[model samples]
Target: MCRWLAYSGTPILLEELLYKPEHSLIDQSMHARLGVGTTNGDGFGVGWYTPDGPAEPTLFRGTGPAWGDDNLRELAHSVRSGLFLAHIRASTGTPVQQTNCHPFRHGRWLWLHNGRIRGFPTLKRTLMLAVDPELFPEIGGSTDSELMFYLALTFGLERDPVGAVERMVGWVEEVGHRYGIDHAMQMTVATSDGQRLWSFRYSSERNSRSLYCSTAVETLRTMYPENPVLQRVTEGTRIVVSEPLGGLVGAWQPIAESSYELVTPGMDVVGRFNPQSAQAGLPVPATVGANGG
Candidate 1:
């Protein structure tokens, strides 16, 4: 329902990805090629870590379309970061307010999501109750995406990113099923804690939203030796997106369904995700032959 991109590599101006590509995130704001919605114009936001500035990332958000935001264009031209996240929203029954924009921040961490909880209105209260009381006050928006972030935090995202998210999804699905919902989850999410980036793709129905990560610079350089753009980035440079930024063949790889990828300094990781682990301490799934997502 929305579009987003996460970049980790040699520092570069935000425009390189937000505007320069033929199918950039800003372009996706108006002409998304792969999202469930053709245009993600409800709102937008960008968060970036300044290596020398603060432990927390800098965030700029707006309640209007990303493509029409002059402030966004200005910042995109001037702000440079090695690690950043950008998102353009397509509201799924949520109010269009600044606080509801993506790349939501909490201290050093930033989180965003694409896709909806199939029956969010019905599932909200139960899921909200699961959030830690201490962290609950920090929630400034009413979107399921933001709630998912808090739920992950409550489940220990600060210590274990993958496990925390799995628990979050499992808890959501568990609650949804108890309410007689058949498919309880659908999402492709990205979250970063200034140092590393973690991304996930999964849906209760098994056919989730789109998610992709950039091919390693070395691999791409070897394949397209004459491409000047490949020369600008370092070996550690990587990008994760709802869809490819450009039509460059072999420059992007699809993350499989029911999986996740973690991008760190040295070796990156890809792993199979299992929500069954989440059901351990939670209520058992009820069998009324119903579902949610």
Candidate 2:
């Protein structure tokens, strides 16, 4: 169990989302209303694309609660980015270390997750052996979240992100079933390649972790014209978080179960996510519901 936020849009200081909101990510670290745990204090990490850096993002991570990290506070106040991701971890039986912190990076891509691969310790070796050998050496942590990233990479993330992630989940579920586990996964994952932001919500049992995307900026502006914050960004700006950053009423929309939201430079897209399970011999579209919007 963990909490994370992904941002894409107008370049602004990191604090605009990380700290300034009423129930910001910092607040979630201590009072997460949706996460399984009230406090996600094992570790935290932030990744962002600088306007003038290499295609890769700059990452600052620590093995401490995001709420108490002084360096995170200073960095959040100082850095500005058009796209970024931040995460606070509540370990699902993993060691607490900086490397295990989220917003994990590989080249220009960054990934983070908020749910565990149920019984990861039992399935770890089987799943790990399936990772692409060339990509295997890049593995740096013992967390299922990081391994999930590599699994997606092994399945082709850079070219087709959605497909890669779908395959990754399918594979995990395939292995879990081999061990007699009924429900193998629960995930609300967000990833970015310094351009578009992609997020997904799915679980084998049809009940996944919580995830929400901001309502379209134009609509929010129409709803709250008096809000100064809404006036600063273009319509392309959007945020995907494990939970709402603030109680803005209409500011957040829950991502449908077994589906994904993609925020690009052009139009944003939401679509059904059917995992291409090897066990099923094809991609299977699990049942999806409104989630009581």
Candidate 3:
């Protein structure tokens, strides 16, 4: 229901990615081509990491739309980072407030998701009841995306992100079914710990939202030898987005349904994802079918 991007690699001005591209995040706020919403103008946020600073990433968020926010344009040119996440929101049954913005933070971690849980209103109490009490108070907004983040944390995201996410989704579907709802999940989530980035695309119905990552930097450079932008970046550079920033033929690669990807210092990794198989990774105490006993 929104559009977003996660960047990891060479330190460059945020504007280089958020504003300069033909179909940049800023432009997408006004005219998103591939996302569920054509205009993700409800609100926006940007989170970036600085090597010399704290373990946690710094955040800049506003309740206003990105396209109308002059401050966003100014900050884009001023901040330079090797890793950052930007999101343009199109509210999915949540209030348009600053607290509901993306790139939600929890200590050193940063998470932002694009999609909604079907029938969340009915599933809210059950889902919220599943989160750890300590983690529950930290939830500042009333959005399903934020709740999913906390659910993952409660399920041990810091130690095993993929597994935690799987449990989170599995739990969502589990609750949705108990409430007589089908197709409970739809998400393309990206998260980072200032060191590595993880992204997932999955849904209850198997037709998840659109997501794409850049083709290997070297591969793109070889394919577009004439492109100067492709030439200057280091090999470790990677860009994951809701849609291609431009129409470069070889630049973007689609992520398959029921899959996840990780962008680390070495080569990026992609793997199949199944929420049903995700239970083992979660703590025994938090299994979806486990009783209050």
Best by lDDT: 1
Clashes of 3: 0
Model 1 Cα lDDT, one tens digit per residue, 31-108: 988877799999999999988988789999999999999999999999999999999999999999999999889999
Candidate 3 Cα errors over 4 Å, as ranges: 277-293
Q: List the residue pairs that clash in candidate 3.
A: none
Predictions: Cα RMSD each: 3.3, 6.2, 2.2
TM value for model 3: 0.95
Ten contiguous residues minimizing lDDT sum, candidate 1: 284-293
Q: Considering TM-score, which of the candidate structures 1 and 2 is the better prediction for this target? A: 1
lDDT of 3 by residue, 50-76 (tens): 999777799999999898899999999
Which ten contiguous residues of candidate 2 have the minimum total lDDT? 284-293
lDDT of 2 at 69: 87
lDDT of each: 0.90, 0.89, 0.89
TM, every model? 0.95, 0.94, 0.95
